[model samples]
Target: MPRLLIAEDDADLGPAMKRALELDGYVVDLFARGDDVLVAVGVGSYDVILLDIGLPHMTGLEVLRALRARRDETPVIVITAFDRTPHRVAGLDAGADDYVVKPVDLEELAARIRSQLRRRERRHDDSLSVGRVTLDFAGHVASMDGEEVLLTAKEFRVLALLMRRSRRFVSKTDLEGELYDQDQWVESNTIEVAISSLRRKFGRDFIRTARGLGYMVGGLEA
Candidate 1:
């Protein structure tokens, strides 16, 4: 699950947005004050942030500025009622990854969030290959011997993490951390099941299971 931080001051809209995003499979932390946003972003590893401009105390622009000044590159979508040219330009200039004018369309907002997360994933794809198999982390794609191999969402997440750390053991605990959010109740065999699925798609040798160290892509010898 992707983590999101929402900085909107509206009592009604803030919780509404949070519920909508959580329903869309995001773990969201919401703040009604702009000053609190800076602190939240500084500590949490969020995939995206939804910031409202007309926030109390500090403005959203100031929070955005503080984030960028610290060299934090987390994707931000400035959400505000202000659709004015100057406001939009200022948010963009402050390093927002995207912007949306409120009365926000939740569907459109969800799509934009997905877009930003996809871009972030693509940057980290970096062509992880082992033997004849290649994993495209960003595209949620994998290919073997120049052919596309379909994978389930959980399968893809498992494979991507393993391939990113190819030839290195990925313990069950570490894999679980990446695959599920804190609120998600992971089954004891969840990783095992996803691995089993991947093995079916890529053959047994494609992913090696060490006796105790855990799962790895191919093998160190490959």
Candidate 2:
């Protein structure tokens, strides 16, 4: 599942958007203040951010500028009631990847999110190859040694993250965040179970574990 952050101060609209996006198969974290958004982005990773311009404590443009100053390239779509030309220009100039006016159409918002994702993915190859294993992100398929490997949705997501960060350990906590949303109930051994299942299909040594550091792929010895 893709992770998203929503910064909207409207008490009702915030939750409504969160729920709707969640229904669209995204793990969403909602914040009502710009300061809180900064805090969240500092510690958590998100594929996209939906920002409201008039947020409390700090304006969305301020947050956007701060992120750009630090070179945080995560895609952001500014959402505000002000649809004036200057407002839109200011947002684009501040490094917003896209902009949307208030009273957003849910379907259009979803499409915009997808577009951002596709654009980001294009920054890298459509597929990843590590040893004999290959993951075709565009086709949503995995294969090993020219043979197709079956994977459930959760399993595929877990594998994608690990393969993308190949040669680097991905902590279990990070995997959990990628696999499930806050509202979902996750088993203590959910990651372990998935890892074990993947090893069964891909070969026992395909993935390696680092006691406290977590798991990784592309560590196969020659």
Candidate 3:
């Protein structure tokens, strides 16, 4: 099972999030203090770390800075109730993979977690590209027509998965878990909907569907 570290100060919310993620099949370690988090991170094999901005002993931002200073590339996502642009900017610049302003919807938070994990996986892949779409695994971004195509968090993840294995069918269930919690109960068409939306944002020809299989993004009909 995947391991996750949740650094949250709220007595109630922290455990709440842990319970939710644990039932989703992740082995979660919850910490209410930043100093403890720092210590634990240095010694633990964490696949994902869900951090809150407010923390005792050390600020969450301080912990994040400390982790990045040591070149820890483990995905750290800041989940805070504060929705300020300056704070968000600081978190990303400090090496956070993503941020969520609370009170978070459990389903959405799970989706964000799935997206970050998949994104990290894509980084270690050799390379990903299809048609005009060029994905830089090292740089962690996608491009088309020589322009950096702006993609939402979910869009980038979904596109990366398909482009990494171009000409292959990706089933909805395969995508479902990677984009949501196991108990989040997304509709079967959730993958289809997300893909359809992405197709419109990009170009319809960019993604192809194989009736009973799933979706593919790459190459031409020829």
Clashes (N, CA, C under 3 Å) per candidate: 0, 0, 0
Candidate 1, residue 185: Cα displacement in angstroms equals 30
Sort by lDDT, top down from the best: 2, 1, 3
TM per candidate: 0.59, 0.61, 0.57
TM-score attained by model 1: 0.59
lDDT of 2 at 101: 94
Cα misplacement distance, residue 205 of candidate 1 (Å): 40
Better of 1 and 3 by TM-score: 1
Tens digits of lDDT, candidate 1, 1-222: 788999998999999999999998899999999889876765345778999988899999998988776656678999989888998899999999899998999999999999999987776655556667777766768898889998877787788788666546789998998877642778889999999888888888878787878888745234
Can you give the lDDT of residue 63 in candidate 3?
92
Which stretches in model 2 have alpha-carbon errors above 4 Å?
A: 126-169, 172-222
Those runs of model 3 whose alpha carbons end farther than 4 Å from true positions after fitting are 127-222
Best by lDDT: 2
- Give the least accurate 10-residue stretch of model 2, judged by summed lDDT: 213-222
